[model samples]
Target: MHADADIPTEIQRTLTEFLDVQEQRLAELGPELAEQVQAARDATSGGKRLRPSFCYWGFRAAGGDPERPILTAAASLEMLHVSALVHDDVMDSSDTRRGAPAAHKRFEALQRARSEASGSGGDPVSFGIGAAILLGDLCLIWADEMLHTSGFDAAALARASKFFDAVRVEVTAGQYLDLVAQASGTSDLDLALRVLRYKAATYTVERPLHIGAALGGADQHLIDALSAYGLPLGEAFQLRDDLLGVFGDPAVTGKPAGDDLREGKRTVLVAHAVDHASPAQLAEFERLFGRAELDDDEIQLLREILQDSRSVQACEDLISERTAEAMEALDRSPVQDETSRKALADLAIAATSRHL
Candidate 1:
């Protein structure tokens, strides 16, 4: 459970170099688009670049060079992630992200300022949302372009492209399931776990590792082994994120406390709480969940109930189990490189560790 700040020196060096290259590439799009890219890049700052690190090490594990195509692909994956976050903030109506004003909100404020100066007679919020959406789309397009132009061999390109496409489809399907679960009040734990696999696990860890491996010319056996390790590690990562959404310190997580409660996300933790809640607790949750007007006191009470009901403990136990499975999978992997294996193991620890 070491802090992400305590990442191994080589991994940290690789990430810093990767980010520098990304920044330089971002600057190549000219001043106007570069500002947009910079804004998007700002969204990524001040958090664990866990996914890219996974991809980088995955490449190393498969005997891939981290300097060119592999690192470029990892950067593109991060851009895709940034695009998703921008849209997610808009869809969730979140006012803050990364301890700052959400992109859409920031754009809205800028739009209003411009509109007021020019006496424009249009909806500023709508204008801002539209701008943000286009910005996200631009980032997505750039992500694809980054990967496409990396100049890998035909076979490697084909494999990586297939992985990328599958990742996109799975994430979208997971998002659909999430929306459906929210609208229908289904919240089945199995269904939630499925969403976790598609939405977070595969895209975040498994496919990234596979893509890196495929680009590096790894065989099917190695790819399958990485998937085994990645799946549980990815789930553990998201589960920890869900916990942070509710219980994390705002200063550390860069979001308001009880944000998941406010958004009414049907995370595994929430699902467990609902399943184990007493009648009175259920009533209280029914009254409070998804209410825009819920006060801090209500949020605090819900937190207490979640802790009291032992759902948090259950979630912690699940995280521990998943992390252990990830380690076991890694141990069984045929990746013989000592540095790569240690990096992967360290990544697994960093992914699920509570210290962030």
Candidate 2:
């Protein structure tokens, strides 16, 4: 979703400063440690800044001051997002992310170069995975340090941290659920939605909003209202992502076509197709859907089957419905800031309307 694209210029500046400080501090350790920090900086550098934007707007909607500490607090979400993506690539065994070789792939290639230079006898692939895993963990730890040192008072930081802690735990648990779904090949639509709720929605929107609202000293009523707006919008966000994973151009989306299918993702789109397809189409889907050998032709065949079963339109309808619901929730929210509320409305459209 790279570089705070849609909103909040200040948030991006704060994030960059925070990372610079992190790099300088890490440099005290050793050059190798600095290299790893550089990897983290590289990984963290660009993104749509979806989480930070949501948090910022949420803080604004609750009438929180446009201040540095809160912005720093919001920027922490970027590191959290980096952690998620790095680990997710490793878990999915994905080849690329945002048009670059994935973190693990980047490290694997580094291992290869070092091996060639030193004539080492280690396994590059394993070394890459190990390094990437540690990098992801470091990103998580860095996010915590950023939050703790964001210059908020203890009471305010604690308030935001409640949501922050819960968000990390929820998303990680959701990740495990998603991995389980992939391994078991569970195609049940309800289970898929559950996984979506835990894995993507909370991290993407809901908790970001909650964290911001908490910092803004929102009442429970306001928090609940924001959750109402965030969750449905968050679902629409992930559903759009699923559609893009299958249908988006590699040139723009930065991953190969059919990458999700290659990973055997049990998306609601695929689950809906499973429910509605004809026997012949189902047969074809099962044959090629999760196979490692899926070629372009097979991928096309799968796309066609999904279309024939009307899953594409069904998913679109869900996105439209959820978007409307999120807007309605925003309308009902007790937020007094008309400008920020309007921005949130625009953000809802941006989240669901883009082809990226």
Candidate 3:
């Protein structure tokens, strides 16, 4: 946001350095935990880095210095993000992440090969589950370490701690809501948005901005402004993600197309489709919505329904409206830094319009 292209690069560099330091710290826990540590490292690597960027720019926008304390805090957001993703893969039974073997899948393969090699029978599935759980726990632990040991002053850390703590709560509640929504066959747009807000949007965009701004001692006014911008944009981000989850190319998203359909995700788009379907279409929806064995034909049928029902266009329109609202909020906010404002605006576009 410094109008210098270097700000993001600098943020990425700092984040990398922080992870490296934590990886070195993990090494101190000895060789037995090496595999878990490596998994943690892999999980933390090569992301869009969206949360940290928001935190960093939020800090800058709020008149915080581009120094180690804020940068380290921003890096902690990434750790939390990776922690969520690793656990999410477990919950979703995802086989791949970022175009490679998912944590549980990788561990499962390792366990199977090791058991066969040793000629001693073992349950690789159980082992994979256990190992992946521990690795996910390790990432959560490391996220805490990244934040507390970031050399930030105790006062600043204290200031951010409340919102930082809220991230975990919101994430847990969000996940629970999602699980229940899927199980109960929820298709209400309001419920879907509630799940989106709790499970993803808040922690994904809003809280990171709040945490960073809080570190700089933001008053209620500034925090409110950031939240006003962040919440809508965050919802837009997840809505875009829902689109990709169902309709995107696997090559771009690093997962199978229609993965959400297989998982029976009750996204707002699905909710819309359900709300507007004819009787026969509703019967077809019942048949194919969550069928794991759904073939290409079924997937296509669902897509056509979503498009014809206007759900897809509705989501796109929502994204555009949210993006515009976020920009307007930023414009009216008290943060006077032009460069940071520009950066946040750019992020609004990226988060909404992205293909990945």
Candidate 4:
């Protein structure tokens, strides 16, 4: 591990400049719409800004200008990400995000204030969740509108629109697979990898690069090469995320310790543990897995079991292997620009190696 800030200072500066324009554009709406947009903007605070940075560099790597439309598109993608977080927090019933109150929780507080003024008998949590859902929908629509309204010609707009559509479908499918895996208790490694590809790989890395490259008129060969690099990196990133969910410090991660354990996520770590646990250990796991009443002691025991079984080491090894694969893909790709290739490689390393 390395931090993203340590990778490339100039790219970070370019990303900040792009965010300024995006913030201005987000503000240039009707008063009520502006308020909604502002709420969405507020939700974006303290993120890694990884997606937008990916989109920006993807564009630059493909020789696209970081001008108005490109910036707008990148910002719009960020807004879409914010929208996803809002809904995800609601679904996960998560109270905190990025070291602050979740958006739905923020809205619930607003709902409580409004109810107090009106003496209304309404559930603030439900109201807040409903409102956040609607807001997310609005952001998704606005993201499309922003992309469409960018000064690109009809042909370019169509291509970009197609890319966005594919991204949306793939991400949705990934989410569905995640929910299904959680519900069905299926921990097959192959199934887990499939979910990883849809949920993290394509949307997080591959499609972002493809969308930017397509907008920049990149040919199919370059797009394929980028996908080859992005897919493994994205998988490695998700696997790292899964590890953090179980083992990371709550203070740094801004999430509950053992939250994934409580949620019973069928991540690769869990799958490995299940495969390796002895009958006695499996009995303990069966008793504790997905139980809402599991206590800190139980969680600690489960963690110890995972450690004793070497599941953690297995995940670490997998991450290293995937990183090597990603680097190989990047090295073998036909990307001509040394700077862009190095930046992308550095980002892949940073993304997978992040601790929080």
Candidate 5:
């Protein structure tokens, strides 16, 4: 197996080479398509790369050797993640991602520039939305292509394919549920948690591990064991993300403070706050929460309510509880070696931490 540092380096290298080939192939389509392709590249660049790491370690735990093929397969998961992110930004009408203009926003700026140059009449926002959606679809297709073309043998790919397929289906269903939650404007804890499970939890952790284990020819017992370890860890990871969405530094999280509150996300934190709030607090919260135009003072007030209502503490407790459960499961898992266990343990810490 390669050193820990090599994994990200190798994944980056694999993705770069693959994208280069794609760029070259699309070059024949002309310069008009160039910027659109570049948007896809930008969307995929830079993140924690947690999904790939989990897949790599899952393979290791299942007794698979460290190899470039696994990295390629893992990198494909990153491609899928990018697809989700680009589409998500569009759905959420987000302005920035990773400290830069999001895919749709970037395309919007391009359209605006072109319209100005040609003295043309067109709706830049609509153009951007249409283009970004197509870009997301392209990324989705490329994800499947990357996975199939990853140098794993046909038998291994076949073994892993079901998990890959399931991940896509589950994540899409989760996305739909999220849309419903946001539109319904309800604050039920059960609904909030269900969205978290399918949208972020399983997608973020369990299925990636399953794919890697299947690729390594792990039996049903090992697959179930990974689920035991991964599911809670994934939930904890998303809880941390929900907290950060409201509290993290923009420099670190690449979004405005209280962005989730502004979006009126029906997170477990919000549900808890609603459950615990006084009637007056609930009335005020209903008025201010999820208003995109919420000012700094309003955001701070909302933060205070969350703290005063003990919603923040409740979320912290859940994170700790879920993390403890994950650690216990990991301890009991039938992994191939101590090193794999150690790597996964480190990942659990990093995945749920505020500063990761």
Candidate 6:
């Protein structure tokens, strides 16, 4: 795990250098662009760096050189993740991220200050949304630029590009699926699981692993092996996240308590709750589950319902089961590097851990 710990440091370093270059280019355009670039910086800073870690360790497991320029390529995934987060926050109307104002909120404040100083009538909220959308698009573009300019030879970049493209398409499609699920208000466990698998699971773990493995020139057999280990672990990762969304400490999660409930996220845990809740509990849940203005007492009641219905326990059991499956796969994986194997195994635990 000590070796794995350096992955975030390496990713941060790569991102910092890349962003500095981006800032310099933006500065050449005008001072007006400075704030936007800073907003991108703010959004990108400070995260678990899970995607890059998975990418790095995947490359390692496939016998890539330790000194290879993989960090630059891996850091691109972080940029893509930042893009998703910015858009996601706007979609959820989230006010904060990482304990700070979300990108859209920050832009809204800027819009308000400028509007007041200039004595102009403007819709700050709309401007904020539009600007944040553009920022997300910019980060999406930067992800591609970073990977293409990562100093990897054309052959390696070509090998990795397919997975990179697939991840972007799959994640975007998954987001749409999530939007559909929420809009339809369907409690279908199948729909919820579909959203979970496509929206977060593959992009979070499998594709990143595949990209790194491809970069390492791994064969199809090894690639399939990584998928066996990555998919279940990825689902467990999101399941843990769903639990944390409801019960995790705000300070630890960097979001307000029960934000997911407020946002009406159609998570697997919630789906399970709907399935298992008693008639009275179900009615109460239907009333209060997605209400935006739910008070503490209401939140507590929902929590009680979830607990009483054994939804929490069910999710925990799934996490344990999925994690065990991932570990078993990893144990029998064809990866020859002992350190990388251990690191991947450790990552599965960390990702699925109860801690926020």
Reference-based lDDT, each prediction: 0.79, 0.87, 0.83, 0.76, 0.90, 0.90
- Minimum summed lDDT over a 10-residue window in model 2 is located at 1-10
Q: Which pairs of residues collide in candidate 5?
A: none
Residues 1-356 of candidate 1: C-alpha lDDT, one tens digit per residue: 12222333433343345446656776776655554655665665656767667777777788886555565666667777777878888888888888898888877887788889999857879977887888788778867876787667777888888888888788878888887767766457887788888889998999889878878788999999999999999999899988888889898887888888888888888888888989899888877887766788999899988898898899889899999999999999999888889889978877888652
Candidate 6 clashing pairs? Answer: none
Clashes of each: 0, 4, 0, 0, 0, 0
Candidate 1: TM-score?
0.90
Worst 10 residues of 1 by lDDT: 1-10
lDDT per residue (tens digit) for residues 1-356 in model 6? 23445888888888889989999998999998888889988877889999998998898888888678888889999999999999999998999999999899998999999999999958999999999999999999999999899878899899899999999999999999888888887588999999899888899999999988888888888899999999999999999999999999999898988888888899999999999999999998988877889888888888899899999999999999999999999988899999899889889988999674
Sort every candidate by lDDT, greatest first.
6, 5, 2, 3, 1, 4
**lDDT (tens digit, per residue) of candidate 2 on 106-151:** 9999989999999885899998999999999998998898789988
lDDT of 5 by residue, 137-197 (tens): 8889989998899888899999899999999999999999888889988798998999899
Q: Which candidate order results from sorting by TM-score in descending order?
A: 5, 6, 2, 3, 1, 4
The list of candidate 4 runs beyond 4 A from truth reads 1-35
| Model 1 spans > 4 angstroms off | 1-35
Better of 1 and 6 by lDDT: 6
My TM-score estimates for the predictions, one after another, are 0.90, 0.96, 0.94, 0.88, 0.98, 0.97
Cα deviation at 324, candidate 6, in Å, is 0.5
lDDT of 3 by residue, 219-312 (tens): 8899999999999999999999999999998988888889899889999889988988787887888789988788999999988888888889
Candidate 3: clashing pairs of residues: none
With a 3 Å backbone cut-off (N, CA, C), the pairs that clash in candidate 1 are none
Scored by lDDT, model 5 comes in at 0.90
| lDDT value for model 2 | 0.87
Question: Candidate 4: TM-score?
Answer: 0.88
